[model samples]
Target: MAIYHFEAKMISRGTGRSVVAAAAYASCSKIYNDYDGMMHDYTRKHGCVYSEIFLPSNAPPEWQDRTELWNAVEAAEKAKDSRLARELIVALPVEIGLDEWKAILKDFISKQCVNKGMCADVSIHDTDGHNPHAHILLTMRPIDDKGKWQAKTQKEYLCKRGDEERGFTAAEFKTAQADGWEKQYQYKVDKKKLYMTPTEAEQQGYERVSKNPKSTRYGRQNPICAEWNSEEQVLRWRKAWEGVTNKALEQNSIDARVDCRSFKECGIDEQPTIHEGVSAHIIEQRGGVSERCEMNRQIKADNALLLEIKKQIKKLSAIVVDKVKKTVLDFANTLENLRNRYIFNRYEITQNENISTELKQYNTTIDVTVQRYNGIVQQLDNKITELKKMKAEQKHLNPIHIFRHKELTEHIDKTEKEIKKLQNLKSAFLDKMSCKSEKDIPQY
Candidate 1:
């Protein structure tokens, strides 16, 4: 089965990573970093089946070269802790052969990344062929219409206008400068540092000291770049990839479908498994299964059991909630038809005995139905009891069967609620029947 996996990360200088090196490692090639005089060589690394670079319309045509593109990205950011690039690691459907991987990935990346104006370098790896996946290296900054790297953040200064202090970018401040807006600076006042405008400092008998103006933390991120960095955008990208991959899987006549959401988000009650990363993959590739793989297998087995339990509950719901309820309502309507005829004084004395006989028959039928529903409830109760007993015995064991016990508890609670709903619905039908007891008003 093809599983869903999409992870977003940054190639950041703060983490001591260079985008140029990341590009080389992902593409399985040799590239030299112009920023730090380091050569990243992954020429002999295994399992890179394909690599390609995609560029936007406004981007330089020469940026199609992976090394040149990333080196330019490194050169653009002049900070020690700069975020170099955005990277997405996504799993490809293994059922699709290597021959068709490129077209699917090209459509996916072009729609999700490159069209958003980020230069994307895509690389697919399938060393063991079963774990086929791709690494998407994307530039952080956007290229302008002139093919130059746009500023990730423009300088914004804090300006004072009357009692209001607001921030303006370099371009906005140009016009804002004529509107009684003065830049604020740190002023020395009675051995304390105070931030005020030059006029305010003079009026307060203070001296301006600091030449550097205050700015917002993280400055002002480029709108496009900031949108790309948002959680919603990442989620959108994941969903987009899932849609594309599932389409390919369907085209190949594969039986499996993938979802991008977590188990909880997908409304699944099963616990999710842990990610078995590089070391585990290496072990499995060498024909030795790792402990994590064993754990995942166990998890899959537990999930299958939980799904079976859910299916049984769904069947019960279909019977009690839909079929049984609808039949009861139909019976109620039929009883109401007779009552309506009697209510409007349309029944003659000759028909009174016949109507009474019919009412008695309806009472007997309702009783039988109520009894049948009671039986169903009893059966559900018995199942819950068995589950609880199993849960208790498992809890007493050394390992305690943690997952099963928890699911069983939830199952028990859900069943009890369903039983409550069944009881209430039965009472509602009995309320409309009007002669629920045999001892009182039975021969009416």
Candidate 2:
């Protein structure tokens, strides 16, 4: 799922140093590298001082036009005049494949500016985690002098003056000014609320900017704390609570995914804890697959291997049988040639009645050669017969044959034991599918 996770800070023109400007610079240097030729488009489509141009209602137009948002933020030394500089922070989803993140920022500014009754001046870009973010620069002074805002502080007026008059060097002054702003407009925290506390609301899981502890029953100041009385109890508590947090996080994530609300509005107070729990559960579910799926995958892989083996066996058997046939044929031809030579030599011996001693010796040599040829031809016949038997046995020795063979008997037995596990998974899925009402289904 796509998410926008970002934080915005108000910078002072007097100080010249700005967190918002730094964030912008970082986005330019890092984020711009991803989409080729998108930087120029980003500048044109979404004005450079994004928040001021699109979310016009977020900040007063006169405030940014006179102050020059970029110039004020670019200067590092000028301290921010909280009295004259206001910023609104917001995060919203901009899917990865959607229009460049800057475009989404423009649309969001248009909607939120009108809703909040402020002028729009926004800056938005994707973050390191691929989450998009927006920064809004707002006018500290009210549009109408007698509106909700009454008057501006002298310090704010001085910072608004030209560069020569605005010297940003006073850390102590800035701190005191920030502190005064909080005292006048601090957030109100109600203790009896069962939902989240003020501390939770301020966290918002943005950058670590907001900090104000709320009063709770388990506040740090409590004299005595609750703990398990014994080690055994602690172990029991750990086991019992282990799955509870995971269940809550999973349910919360599902709600957050479907609901159009911020993290705070979604009832998530401890972001880190919830994030960890949900991640762990997802990993666990994936690692431990259903027995039915596992068996199915294994069976498919084995069947493919068996098919390959059978093809190889068929090719090899053809080659062996052909070689034996050729060998037998060659021996038979040699035997025939030997018999013809023997008959010719016998006819010559019979025609010469008064044979010489040398001729008699030649006759004996011919006789022995013929006998050797007969013996070799008989051996070839026997080898051919053996090859034919082996060819017949090949079909019986196929993979199915081997799988059921005595050698693999033990393995087959174990596989049968595992079949029940897959059956159980199928049964459970069927039962779940059959449930017609919520009451019929099991609860956590």
lDDT (CA) per prediction: 0.81, 0.39
Candidate RMSDs in Å, in order, are: 24.9, 41.0
Off by over 4 Å in 2: 4-16, 19-52, 55-104, 114-117, 127-129, 145-150, 153-444
Clashing pairs in 1: none
Model 2 TM = 0.25
lDDT of 2 by residue, 1-444 (tens): 533233334445455534344334432322221111222112223222233343234343443442234333233122344323345444444333224345444544454343444444555544343344455654333233223332232222122111222222234336644533111112434432222323343564322323432222322211111111224433442333323323333544533322324557666532221122224445458784333343344444445544554564455456666486775565456556655655665465544434545555865665564444445445545545554554445546666676445444554444444444444543444354464432543322
lDDT of 1 by residue, 186-283 (tens): 99988889888888888878877889887777577789988988999998998898898899999999999999888899887888999889898788
Candidate 2 lDDT (Cα, whole model)? 0.39
Off by over 4 Å in 1: 283-444
Q: Return model 1's CA RMSD, one decimal.
A: 24.9
Which candidate has the highest TM-score of all?
A: 1
